[model samples]
Target: MLVNGFYSVVSWIFLALTVFAGVALVMAAIAREDAYRAASKNTKQFWLIILGVAFAIMLLVPMMFLQIIAVIAAIVFMVDVRPALRQVSGKGGGRRGSSSDGPYGPYNGGR
Candidate 1:
């Protein structure tokens, strides 16, 4: 009985983390293609943490196949989108621009 209760609690925690990571991933995707540091770095960490948490949870509770699948999906997102975003954002080095420009706008050309 005690072991069952412990696993139940763990399952709930994993479920909550899964939901949070999934939502964060969606928000990051929506904010993609932007040169903003917050969006870029956040998106990168979001996937990394997602995969990490998913793996940890799966290791702890191998019965949760859905979590495994979520990790796979996150891996795909990380590989497919993260590199292009990092290239644009320059390794989270940050860019500067006036308020008139958009969030991800390019710097002035010194014209």
Candidate 2:
């Protein structure tokens, strides 16, 4: 009844947290080591270990306390470190464009 439905909701929430941590781990791995230094963040290896443990805790640990701790680590990486790395490395996303540049390229008026 209501208990079953509550458990189902909790399961889905855990699933989402697991997936988020996994994705953060991959992102941390992809960034270059130098980028982290340039961004004044922890070394890439450190973040990888944190995120890796978080992912593992989600899968192997049944304790909600550990899962919450892991989730917090992943969220910090996503919110703080990820943005700094992207800004330093310019590889967080796809092609970049200058402020004046249009969809294709810089547009000039008839001159």
TM-score of 2: 0.82
- TM-scores for every predicted model: 0.38, 0.82
- lDDT of candidate 1 at residue 20, scale 0 to 100: 54
lDDT of 2 by residue, 1-111 (tens): 999999999999999999999999999998999999999998999999999999999999999999999999999999999999988877667777778777888766544
**CA RMSD of each candidate after superposition:** 10.8, 3.4
Error of 2 at 65 (Å): 0.7
Q: Whole-model lDDT for model 2 versus the true structure?
A: 0.93
Candidate 2 total steric clashes: 0
Query: What overall lDDT, based on C-alpha atoms, would model 1 receive against the true structure?
Result: 0.59
Candidate 2 clashes between residue pairs 3 or more apart in a chain or in different chains: none
- Best model per TM-score: 2
| Cα deviation of 80, candidate 2, in Å | 0.1
